[model samples]
Target: MFYDKVFFLGKILLHLSIIYFMIASNKIIYDRNNYSDKELISLYKKLVKPRLIEEKMLILLRQGKISKWFSGIGQEAIAVGVCNALSTDEYILPMHRNLGIFTSRNIPLHKLFAQWQGKKSGFTNGRDRSFHFGSQEFKIIGMISHLGPQLGVANGIALGNLLKNNNQVTTVFSGDGATSEGDFHEALNVAAVWNLPVLFCVENNGYGLSTPSSEQFKCKNIADKGVGYGMESYIIDGNNILEVHSKVLEIAQSVRVNPRPVLIEFKTFRMRGHEEASGNKYVPHNILELWALKDPIENYQNFLRKENILSEELEVLIKEEIVHEINEHLRIAFAEEEISSTTENEIAGVYKHIHFIEKKPNQNTTEARLVDAISNGLDKSLEVFDNLIVMGQDIAEYGGVFKVTEGFLKKYGKDRIRNTPICESSIIEAAYGLSINGFKSVVELQFSDFITSGFNPVINLLAKSFYRWNQPADIVLRMPCGAGVGAGPFHSQTNEAWFTKTPGLKVVYPAFPYDAKGLLATSIEDENPVLFFEHKALYRSIYQEIPEDYYTIPLGKAKLLNEGMDLTIIAYGLAVHWVLDEFKKHQFSADIIDLRTLQPLDVATIYKSVKKTGKVLIVQEDTLFGGIASDISALISENCFEYLDAPIKRIGSIETPIPFAKNLENLYLQNDMIIKEVNILLKY
Candidate 1:
């Protein structure tokens, strides 16, 4: 009993420290006469509009009028206050609950309702879920379902805007649950390091869905988490409109000038369930009753009455006007047509292609290796395109692992030749941010294997941005891939299959110095996000005299290396060189087709070759199973069946991960394996 008393007392002390040791949690910035009657009334209208919309949405959700809704019933003040503070030019990345952001930004009410209804007129053309659409016109970056990733995107926006010399701030929102995510921490650290102009707000609504703060975090407040990153933080009464408005407005104005990040923890609660359909039985009735009495709408109304700025009659008229507006918009949205089910219409704009001025193919008579060729391409691209920005780890001073960007720092300066932290995801997403804001960015991954660290932003956000909202991710991700030279499994991987399966991304795999130079140039110019794969083994192995001047090769087009009718050999990257080497040893009359781009697959060239040869062989440095070889093999067997005289063959590395030891690595990826398979196909 004595031990229990001591533990309880310690717990009480910890709780007291959490509340009081915080960076001034209970600061009152909102004065009684903070605004004149006109200003007060405007603030109240902005605060109440979302409440009326959410209340009506709950009714629609229950009656099955809408498919889903994540009601922000009690937390209207933060969205309104922050958005009110930001100018129309500054961007805001709001979460699912921040409906007031749209209303306050003056987004078309009918279109928002149409988006909720999944109509064609919606912002995302009904491709995205409700409240997950952006409007570039309004400077609103729509929130994704994975809430934490948006913080990194916000960093990208701020980063891009900073480069543009635009004095604009980007504000992003997340909940307490998202604070536990790595993105939140990484984004904050990046913002602090770069001194980016981003206002990070965490609406500490006491819960994330049904999970309480106790389960979500151990920190005193979400704002306290920001203090760890050396960012200024404040916790204010999120329920009070005056406090949220005044505090957020002041911070935003300050952030716009000073150019740094700030974290605000708005103290509020979820009065309703997470959504209308989800029950809230787990919440204690006492806690629910307490939050209900501190309702944001009710408290703000009382604050209005206390100041004598709004009478009961004026309040009723304001509410009636809001309801009428919502109803009038819903009437138009309800009559709007749903998204079309046609095949062509559905797939249109799912992938985008950008036009570029095709540079004349010129041979400047420069002897270069594959790595040198890549550097030449990037050099020429930077020289030609003023909007081009390059970022990677050690690429600035160290000039990258392969020295591809050697002397680039001296050539381009610090802004263009950026060395980034090991945070891959944040940089990739920031590239996306740059692309959307009228800049083209090229991001170099340290290795193809490390792409997993930044996979979410690539696949989920950049891959889907254009499809969802016509947001162009005009960025190139230079991925050094493949096995050999004892780099081992972790650094050596030919991972093109992972992205070829995913739409909205272009895959470029070039063999030899000439193709490498040309394809890198084109990949940078292409509007879509491109995965430019350069084989590590071939970086300096082969040499050729190629064009030093700028050139552009179209993506998805294959080059015929050596043509013959006896057999066809299909390959890309290092595999293409292996075939050429085998040809040097023995004169095998076969059509060697180098697939420069993998995603587009150049099926016409492939099918034509297979038809002429009537027997084909596909080779890759990657493992056999679930690779692009299997897909191409199937395509040939299905379409070129009648033309084939023998079974279509394929050769790839051993299934196990690339080994560390030289002998085991040889067994893992053997070029002689190609010889044995090629012989079998020719003999058959």
Candidate 2:
């Protein structure tokens, strides 16, 4: 009984000691007086100057000199605070409204003005507007207008930095409205799971456009959402420039040491409208007045002056310097010449040297199926390019769901043939990160329908990388497409049309084994990102003449499988095979044109074939309304108007959701019977 009493007293003493240590740590964390007045003033100044610049720019925008502007008026503290804390080696992914932050980072004032004026001398060579600027020299990954997408990109960039074992952090900026997007949730989750060194800055300015934050989210603080993902979070006064800067430096340092993500909620305001032209009357007056009281510049200037760290003379000198700099930049920007005709044509300069290589006769060619071709292509690519990496779910040890990437791990080792988590966003993000860091990545989406989960990374970031940053992302996204495998609606889908509508992405669909091997090789070798869609139905379907050795077929060119004067059948992927079988069975001498690439479409071959046949039938596996058939019909109708003998015919899936029933699914998808409609049209 005496020993038990002694043990209880010892436990009580230990608990008391732990409480004392926690109290001391809390004291240290909350002690603002520990900071020197000079440090506080300097931080305040860094935040105030950017706000002033943003305000002046908005004024210029109102005067019609600036065509477009995304205001960063009240959110100045967040930008300046975070950027000032980051090192030069670190990267930044800014959104449209974060121009003030870029300016603070030393982006040339003349270049910024020139971009706004749409002059050729702009940093992007007038390709992008003022808001979408990037600089490799500044270590800025660039700006994207899409909401919530940059977070995943930041995760990817941070992951890359971690892989290189570099102590650099990647910061991504977004509005409170962006948190509602699916990509935001996915990105935060992945970043937490991977422990990536990134900081997600949520500039919660009370409203997302006209919608108030109170209505959109249930959480009291945006930072509170981080708890759900097991992440560190902080809520700070965005108007308190000194507080913001100090917290940012502390958090960034913590991330560097611990290598984990953090969410910062900057409780700021949008002083101006969303854009310069917006009236902002939709925002309630009471809320506006409340936010006005917390203006970052006003609060910081007052704080600086009160501390005696800044004087009236210094303030006047800084204002004069800023005004003079703005005026000088405006003068140079206005004097710059507009884009001439030569310069307009130069916009297409990237593809000037791009030539289509003709298919050469293969002495050691052997007949194979689409699946074999895919495997052979992977083998050849690995043999040729040392940097090529193949990754996907169940791809490493299990050889993937369709075994398309079989034996890749055995040949390339674990690092190159990586197996990713089931999360689709993580897979795509990893590929994007690897591609940017000089790895030729071939990422596989388990099925075409699942690509929806990774849509933002594909369309917003990968597709725009070249056009936005002038940086080539040699990434290949391979997916098993089409709907005849009894995989049901959720698993079976042809989503090629979805990506084709997005500019800057090259979509390739190879029908035959020969074309599959050749086109896959070409896509792997190309500097730009490519989306390769492999048809599940055609994977096992054998073709007559596939080469045993490796080769490549150029993109943006069509293959004339057969020659006929009666009619022309334009098809791609599985549809091409269906049309071929139908023509053979009906004994119709129809010309068959296979569209190998969708974006840089082979208009020359298509127009030539349609003109000769004087009739066109466009067939695809997607829905009839917005399918590639519509694009083909429009092209032929516009370019070969005089040559057409009858109205163009289109064959595609019925405009309805795919049914789970086999018979209904068969009827919804195109079959050889659709070719009978072409014969009926020829009779006209």
Q: Which candidate leads in lDDT?
A: 1
C-alpha TM-score for every candidate: 0.94, 0.84
What 10-residue stretch in candidate 2 is worst by lDDT?
22-31
lDDT of 1 by residue, 1-684 (tens): 999999999998986565554424433234654578898889889989988888888888878888998878778988998889889888889988899999999987999999988888899888887878788899999878777788988888898888888788999998887888888888898889889898889988877788899898887778888878899999988877877888888888787778898888888877777776786787887567666766777777787788788899999999999999999999999988767777786666777856666677765568999999999999999998998999999998899999999999998998888988889988887887777678889999989899999999889888888999988888999999888879887998899999998888889999889888988999888888999999988998989988868898888889999999889999999889888899889888999999999987899999999899998999898898999999999999888899999988888998898988888888887778777877888888
Candidate 1 accuracy as lDDT: 0.86
Mark the regions of model 2 whose C-alpha exceeds 4 Å error after superposition: 1-45, 123-130, 276-295, 302-308, 338-368, 382-391, 407-439, 456-465, 468-473, 543-550, 564-567, 583-590, 610-617, 641-650, 674-684
RMSD of 1: 4.7
Deviation from native of the Cα of residue 170 in model 2, angstroms: 0.6
Whole-model Cα lDDT per candidate? 0.86, 0.79
